[model samples]
Target: MIDFRYFLVSIAAIFLALAVGVALGAGPLKGELDQQLRGTISAVSKEKDGLRKQIADLQEGDKYRDSFAADIAPDLVKGRLNGQKVVVVALPDADNGVVKGVEQSLTSAGATVTGTVSMTDKWSDPSQRQFLEELATRLVTGDVRMPDNGSAYDRAGVVLARALVTRDAAAAGRKDSATPTIMGAFGEGDLVNSDSDLPQADLAVVVAPPVQAKAKPTPDSDANQAWVSLARSLDSASRGAVVVGDPSAAGDGGVLASLRADKQARGAVSSVDVADLASGQVATVWALAEQATGGVGQYGAVGTTDGALPKRPTAGS
Candidate 1:
């Protein structure tokens, strides 16, 4: 009996030793396993971001230039606006006939031309011309392939939508819909206020340079900070449309930043490079903008909702 008891104690000791060995082996392996899991999660996150960007581009079909473009589509396609002022911007001698032609078509449809301002520098300024050339290159190589000669259509669609919304609102009785007219400046420093009472505007058009087409379109750190400051000074919901002839022109970076930052501001936005944009493309952009605001003509629901402009301003003040 004594011998059996001693043998049983020995067996229990051996089992305890084996248990300790198993725990020691598992500790290092557990850490390695945890590290592997973290790596996998990081990789998956990056892949998801890439996929989402691709999906967004596909969904937008060249309209992803900004967010407001997405919000104001309905009114542009319906031709809900006419008789409102549309502002256009570019160099004085840009030969941007496409931009003017599209605007005219909208006016013919019923929009009022409020103002047109051109930059003094057309081709003589090296910095400005460089900007245009670069912008043209980007248009050709970037996702927004400027239709060799049909760019006016795109320009027309975007502008037309904003005009329609502005005019429709003014006609509907939004007393605040009107704004003081202003021209695009190299750095206009917050030109218009969304809340100001003014000359009874049906719409506001801001013609300017494209600020995001440079080999390094982004401005330096100091410029970037100043641009943000300028954006904060403006009304949060300024409704307007943009027509860009060159993306690399001076002061364009600041403009793009401010407009993009004020994402929810009540407005429509579009751009065209007169130097590179084909006639049809510009027309299409303006037409789309007009249709979103319910201006004159109709565009198929490529980017609009319910095919209706923003509720026309309350009927008659």
Candidate 2:
């Protein structure tokens, strides 16, 4: 609305300022600005390189530790569980490598692995609760007493535990007439899978799924609690039972984490939360041996009030 000359002058002034800035950048300030930018890039690159080296060092350290643990694992657990019959139960998504490592560790400790029982996803599906309840009721033998009050999974746990473990040494490693029937029923129901007949064991190792980075941490979800109920039932029915999982399994929503949070279950069940590592496998075997003697502890890198490993029992005592 004002004079056209004033608007033109204002535009010219802005352009002049920009021209001056460009000249400075290309001339007097050019070297300084370039030097500053180069310095910044160099500093950032150095930091990145430093971080990479640190990560490499950590990885190498871990590799060395795992190697050392594997070498000494046999001696560490030698005769610890001599003559004990142990069973491995793999929860859904359980790491096969870890399960195999645990089996080797148990063998090194002189415990006979009866068989590996793999739980299907149906075990944790809420929709299958009614079916599981019916199955448990139908398959429960007279000798196996059902819990008066608990979830359907609890009843199923009792039935499954009765078939897989026993406190009596004579009964262990010996399948009774009902053993195959019970296992077969669960297998047919698509709740459990086993490669061969699973003899009753003196102790049990329940392998939980490894830590899932993307999974929402639902520590108290019905599915997770179902597993907890099952584990508790197994512990009650067996000589002792230990739940093993990877380190993150002790984080939020992990089955091992849920077990640790439960006051009653934690009191009865021993947990090892680093089963993915050789050291953790060794700890798992030791935890089972501890269980054989009425000891309960949570051992691992995370969520563990107990020490890294149970106290190694002295000879014959």
Q: Which of the numbered candidates is closest to the native, going by highest TM-score?
A: 2
C-alpha positional error of residue 166 in candidate 2 after TM-score superposition, expressed in Å: 0.5
Candidate 1 residue-wise lDDT, 123-203, digit = tens: 223334344334334323122223245222222222222222333444522332212212111223221213222223343
Backbone clash count, each prediction separately: 70, 0
lDDT of 2 by residue, 43-83 (tens): 99999999999999999998999899889888888888888
RMSD of each: 18.3, 2.5
* TM-scores of the models, in the order given: 0.32, 0.93
- Which regions of candidate 1 are displaced past 4 Å? 1-81, 89-99, 118-168, 171-200, 210-217, 220-239, 246-317
Best lDDT among the predictions, by candidate number: 2
